[model samples]
Target: MDNNAILNVAHLNIKFGGIIALKDINFHVPRASITALIGPNGAGKTTVFNCLTGFYKGGPGSKLTLSSKNKSNNLVEMLGEGFKLQDFINPPAFVKRIYFKMFGGTHLVCRAGLARTFQNNRLFEEMSVVENLLVAQHMSLEKSLLKGVFQTKDYLESQERALDKAHDWLKFFKLDKRANDIAGELPYGEQKRLEIARAMCTSPELLCLDEPAAGLNPAESAELSELIIRLRDEHRISVLIIEHDMHLVMKIADHIVVLNYGEVLFDGTPAEVRNSSKVIDAYLGKE
Candidate 1:
């Protein structure tokens, strides 16, 4: 792995009941840059995301490595032998049949500094808008369960830090005015912004977004683009975005990776992707 690469996906393959969704796909996302993943429907774009984020385990001989720029930790090796779906399901402990294999998936991935947002908004509908951001920052809290139970000084400090961080994000997204409003009660555009702010609260070195512009109107999409650019420029966080909006992708992406039939068809600058015959053929079909 090169020192410059923040994430490396090598020979990733995914299958479901003999249906191969991704075939030997490979790519690298560099640090402090915005990379775009674009493809037509059913091109395995989302499947690639699933593999990278640990939602789906890759097939045999597949590998994914992630490294951070500022940290000495080897996230690639720390991920510990790819993902296993069985590990994500927890069985009854009293039955004496509990399997550790069914209990240890990739929650560690997020802890290792990668975070993502889903294609659809996944907010806590009942929680206040500010609470959504606070929940995401739970990992950074300084207090332990024991400290909270005993009402220790650490618990008070952690509570204050969490609230301050939450307020910062709300203000950053211009949602401070609606901090107490329920997440579901906000307008659709505000909900989308809230999701981004929530992901930011995780303080990930690398952030992955799935079609953030899907349901947004042009104005909303423009705002979304600005927010993403702000993330890259102000926070110095690298981003991998899977989007179908060409205008948004072109405007914000420093590099573009195009996929067709679960394979890389083009990888270059946005202008290069726009001009490539292969990209046009994959998206528009031969004339």
Candidate 2:
């Protein structure tokens, strides 16, 4: 865990029965930089994201660690030694231990300042836009829950602060006009923006977005690209994006990691990746 790196994935491997999904992948996502993962379909890109986000654990020697200069200790170290992938992927004898570790992983990751949004827009359909943002701030609100239940003065103050912060993010995403609208009532593009806004409300040091431009029109995708760049330059949040949109990837990525058949075909700046023969072969195929 270097002071400069936000996320470090080393020797990661994932196997489903006899299928080798990912093999010996290693990459570092630097602090405050935007990195893009691009490859053809079935290239194990999403699997890598799953492993990083704790959705799926890797095999032996698969180590995923996150380090933040503002945080006191390494999140991986706190999780303890020998936190192997098999222990997480396969059912272990101690279900509770695994559960604790999984929750701890997410908590430490978020606490270490990381957030993410899925490819499919996930919102509280019944909740208002403001409610959705507020829900995403649960970690911050936890400190006041007990006090608030007792109607303590501090609880009221904390509630007000959380509301203000939520409002600020809504404004940041240009969703202030729909603050009281139900999340599900918003248009597709607005929902996508709300998802990003919700993740931003978490105050993450690093944000991982999965195919955010999937359903956007050309104009909307352009706006998404601008929003991503703004997040990097203005908010200073490191971003790791997994997208299939070449135009969007090229527009904002500081670096690119190209995968092919579960292996690293290329890793470099956007210009290098775009020019690589291997990337071309992987995506466009050889003549």
Local accuracy of candidate 1 as per-residue lDDT tens digits, 57-162: 7778777777863564433333344444554564443222232234534565777678888898999999998789888988888647788889898788888888
Q: What is the TM-score of each candidate against the true structure?
A: 0.88, 0.88
lDDT of 2 by residue, 262-284 (tens): 99889999999878888898787
lDDT of 2: 0.83
Clashing residue pairs for model 2: 113-205
**TM-score for model 2?**
0.88
lDDT of each: 0.83, 0.83
TM-score of 1: 0.88
**For every model in order, what is the number of clashing pairs?**
0, 1
Rate residue 64 of model 1 by lDDT: 79
